[model samples]
Target: MGINAHFELGLGGFSLDAGFSAPGRGVTALFGRSGSGKSTLLRCIAGLERAPVGRLEVNGEVWQESGRGRFLPTHRRPIGYVFQEPGLFPHLSVQRNLEFGWKRIDRSRRRVAMDQAVELLGLGRLLGRAPGGLSGGERQRVAIARALLSSPELLLMDEPLAALDLASKAEILPYLERLHGELAIPVLYVSHAPDEVARLADHVVLLQEGRVIHQGGLNEALTRLDLPLARDPEAAAVVEVRVAEHDERYQLTYLDFPGGRFTISRRALTPGQRLRLRIHAQDVSVTLNRPGETSILNVFPARLREMAELNGSKLLLRLEVGDAILLARITRKSADHLGLRPGQPLFAQTKALALLN
Candidate 1:
């Protein structure tokens, strides 16, 4: 039971034709630039923008089907929608704002408890505060709690962080991560920021000009050199690792993945704690033979799985290390000099990696 949607709409000079299906769990991000129809697609699924020809199903429930003449009105749909701004009642206290939706659902229909919502968003401290007195991040947290109190089967977030500045976005991101970790409902998040998608999304739907260019797991979708995302200089591969050990003297933490162990600045993580790492392709270098006595601490033997020309001067190689995949971007000259080919074993070294949640 997952989401399946197809929508085609023509308004003025813009036309949108897009369809995609994603697992009904985890965070599925609708990623694209402005005017790319991310919001329009969400609206179509929510019944706010009725496309003459469209179909939508969420968690095995049919929300719309134009061909069958079945359509659920916006209010009838079981969804929690969060907009760019926290649209809380300015006059209402945070507790009452959260209860606004909670009080509307029938007791027999309630799936989410009031205390659960409050705890999940850490609203205990702000419950008595007015919306106007809360910070941007705090207000958004209240907004999300309000949405959750409705007991929705699905959550739709339309650039929830877009209106917040850098610091506010940072402040809210951990709360969003906690929500992703604790909630069971499927979340459809819309955003143009690549970092947000990389950090929060488990699956991705890449939209452009009102069409889906690609859709798949976050790691696979972001590492394809052919896509605009991978073409960026900051494009990277994401991997999950567990805390292996920590060196008190060096102030470093060791994380173990299928490929190998990664050494990074120390974090407040206990042993065996799972962490996500982003390894930039630019930070990786390819070598035919293993290097010794080098400053780079992360190196592993990898088999070249595939190669693609990224541009006139650069090439992208997809390598398999143990059970994990790593992407390396190297110059065409280096590739030619090394005579790189599929099935060949080589050493890959990384000078930088970032921990993402």
Candidate 2:
């Protein structure tokens, strides 16, 4: 089951014509540059913007259908919205603010328990604290908890960490990760930050000029040479791996995936623990034949999937390493020197990769 949405709206000079169906369980990130209508499309899904032609359905429940004269108001939609700011009530205590949403639900309709919400968000200690006394990250955590208490079917977060400083963003991201792993309710996250999308999104809806340019699972969409992400300086591909073993002498931990295995700086990780890591395109270099000896520890046999011109100076290669796809950005000179071609056997030497914290 999934959420289906299509919206067409015109606000003055700008127009929005976007539609996409996203998974009903995990987080689906709406990713785009600023002014790309990420927020406008979200508002349309929330029924906050009455698009002239719109249709929204969540797991078979119809929220709005413009052609049938059916439109559920924002308040009636089973949604929880978290904006840039925490938006906690100024006069209320943290406990009361959470209860504001909880108390509104009748006993029979309460799917999320109050205690569970508090625990999931780590809000027990700060219940009595007023919103003003809490830090920016704390307030956001409270806002998320309050939203869950509403028993929403869909959670909408719009740049939830944009207002926070680096420290605050660091503080809140783990909690968000917990939500992504533990919660059953679906989430639609809106953010322009690539790091945020890379760390949290299981799926992506790429928007450009108010249109959905692409939509698919995170890895496929992120590494698509045609997408803008592949051309960015920070362009990278996210790969999920399981901890294989640890090398105590060398202080390294091995991670395994279908693409093969490699070791990283040892962490206090247990065998079989699963995590996602980013492999930056710039960190990858391709060779026509396997190298005899190298300082690089992560080198795997790969086949050239495709290539695209990144710019006049650089070229982007999509390499298939076993079952996984990895991106490599190399100088046009290096590509020409290697005579790269599709389906050519090659070795991808990766210099760096980092686990999503």
The CA lDDT of each predicted structure is 0.91, 0.93
Off by over 4 Å in 1: none
For model 2, residues 41-83, the per-residue Cα lDDT tens digits are 9999998899999999999999999999999999999999999
Checking candidate 1 for backbone clashes, the offending pairs are none
TM-score per model over all chains: 0.96, 0.98
**What is the clash count for each candidate, in the order shown?**
0, 0
- lDDT string for model 1 (279-316, tens) is 88888888999998788889999999888888899998
Candidate 2 off by > 4 Å? none
Worst 10 residues of 1 by lDDT: 224-233
lDDT of 1 at 1: 88
Clash pairs, model 2 backbone: none
Ten-residue stretch with the least lDDT total in model 2: 287-296
Cα TM-score of candidate 1: 0.96
